[model samples]
Target: LRELKTKIACTIGPSSGDRGTISELINAGCRIFRINFSHGNLELWKEWTDNLRQVSSSLGVDCVLIADLRGRSIRFASPIDAKTYSAGQTFYIVRHDGREGEVPSVDSPEFFEAVSENDVLVSDDGRGLMRVLKRETDKIMVQALSKLTVRRGKSLVIRNKEIPIPNYLSHCVDQILDAVRLGTDYLGLSFVTSPRDILAVREFLDKNGSDIGLIAKIETISAVANVEEIAKVSDAVLVARGDLGMHFPLEEVPRLQERIVGTVTAIGKPVIVATQLLGSMISESVPSRSEIVDVMNCVVDGVDVLMLTGETAIGSYPVETVNWLRRIIETYEGDVRTRREISQDQLVDRFALGVVELAEALNAKIGIYTKRGNTARRISRFKPRTQVFAASNDPKTICRLMMLWGVEPIHVDSKEYDRGLEELEQKLKEQNLVKRGDTLILTYGLLDKPIHTIRIVQLIS
Candidate 1:
């Protein structure tokens, strides 16, 4: 399989959870796996994580596992039988005991108090919306704006209120702790509203002595307002276009995505463009023209990762979705040849860019030796024409580098300069990443050392 600068992250679920199917996904160029903590139990997640690790090890590939935390889902308690509603129907949402025809009490008491008449409540994954016509002490009378099949646990989004969700919801705290114990490479916090939310997760991880990367999902207006502050503290930020669209106008989502990507890129952190990149592929064998255009636009916008949610989780053509996404990214990125330069004021970032420019100008590959993958990320922002071989002994660093653009991470053993370089060169040659007589611009730095070195190397038989 050919590698692209923008990585493909597939959601692991019942559709693609088996060993054989996962192997096919990896062979089809899926670089990362997202284990949603919102759906399954801890036992199921651990099983999936262990299986993913074994599969990646056996296949000799890098598949970074991300545990997506379910933070503050605004659903309501339901009776034994859930009722479905149609357009123009009047439904009632009660905070107390609701009858069979009436809507059940919502999870958050704040939701009932914050919403008023004339406000809109979106449900059915944002496809179904309702307008509140009247509000009483215990119930809200709403007019269905669209037909929807309401289920027991479906979350309702109130567009008027800026809902304050907890950093770690009740159900996700145990999952987060489990993720740290299982050595998950990253944790995706859904519905993040501020920098303090990111810090909350960070504090918990720190208290537990875990170093998992925190990815803040930008799905709310508050998150967009505080995106820069959140990006400043987050390891990465995801443009979760699903709920984000519900919060803002659908036409405005693309611009919001671009804005968030640019902001996070400027901060020198990875930006993931997620949710419905290939939504049509969930049922169809191929994606629609607009979906293809959307993927291409995101790549052009300089997103580090393109993610598939339902397209891979419960889709009929999960493997094909990933393959098609990879093909689209490869074709578009090759044709566009765009460069996303870091706008940081640090000398190290400038040095990294200079090295990348040198490599591009000289038509030489960049050989980077980094322990934490920061140097490689800095270089990747430039989008060099030549390949980037990021060599790291740290497994976590190598795994996390899977999300980086234009980087092919290789794991090395020795920290010694000559030994590590020789091993890395051998691996690259064996893998045909570099050929004999190929020139390389090498960058390396010791973990304790404050200095970074950039040099030249030529391979000869």
Candidate 2:
């Protein structure tokens, strides 16, 4: 099997939640499993995480678990039977209170207040489009612009509007702490609008003494406007094209994706392109040709990861979806020689750049011994053509490094730098990652010392 450079993230749900199915997904090249808190309760999430960890250990795969927080997003509070509306059909939406009502309702009072006459409401990421004809205190009359099926817990957004909802992180503090206790490697914060949003979560995690990485999902115009600062505060960035389409015109989504990916990449953080990468594969066996081109384009654009939301979460062919994604990413990496020109003024970043430059010039595989995975991330920011093998003594760091582009994370038992380097090289040779007579460049850092070391060596039998 060919190794993929661009990582694949699979969202865990009923369709692919079991241990056997998760094992198949890992084999199909999914390294990160996203547990969406919007859909399941804590009990269900615990089951999924337990199964995932067992399967990963059994398969000897270092998988990363992301607890995706449903932050301040509006959704249907009560279960609504699937209802279909045709174009030009009229309907009513009201605030979902305890009282029973005939009209469909949402859980957000802010959503009702922010909407007005002529304002458009979108559900399920543009599947359901309705225009507000009139509004009362708690109810709004809407006309469907296109045919759509409404279901329970479906997310709703006001087109081109940012609702003033309460802080979801504050509301879900217990859930976040529970996820941290469940050994989640990362936290995916949804609907983040500014760096302060990320900082709030970071502060909470710090207070709890958790080192979980934060992924900022850029889905709104405000987030796009503050993407640079957001990316700087975040451990990674996810370009949520689904909500972006709802917030902006469909025609501008591609440009927005490119701009966000470029900005995140330049900041030296992992950038993930998500939502509808393989939407057709939700029910179909094969992805559409355009989906193939879209994945290729993301690869060419130098994205660190490609994420599947509904495609794997609720799709019929979850494993096969991952298999196809892996194939597409591998094919693109083999045929393309794209590079991102990144400039960093920081001393560590400059040192990492020098390491990448040396490896490229020598046409050698790069080996890094990172304690917190910072060295690997800094090197990845340069987008080197040669392979990168990042070894970390910390298991969490090993799993977190899986999100970086072109990085193959390996866990070493040794904590000392010299021993860790030797163990990494031995494991690389044993796995046939490096063979005799091959040139290898090694690097590591010392926190106590101000300087980092880099050396080139030739493997010998």
Q: In TM-score terms, which candidate is top?
A: 2
- The positional error of residue 25 in candidate 1, measured at the CA in angstroms, is 0.8
CA error at residue 365 for candidate 2, angstroms:
0.9
Superposition-based RMSD of candidate 2 using all C-alpha atoms, in angstroms: 1.7
So what's the TM-score on candidate 1? Answer: 0.93
Taking the candidates one at a time, how many backbone clashes does each contain? 0, 0
Put down candidate 1 lDDT per residue, 1-461, tens digits, no spaces. 66788888999988988888899999998879998876767888888888888999998787889998877767766633667778999877777444443445675677877888999988755777899999987689999898866655566788857765444445467778888888899999888788877888888888888999999999888899999999989888999888887787678888898888888887778899888888888899988999989899888777889989888888999999988998898888865444545456687878887897788888998888888888887787767778888888888888878888889988899777557667788889888888888998888766677688878988886
Reference-based lDDT, residue 386, model 2? 91
Query: How accurate locally, in lDDT, is each candidate?
Result: 0.82, 0.87
TM for every model, in the order presented, reads: 0.93, 0.96
Give every collision pair in model 1.
Answer: none
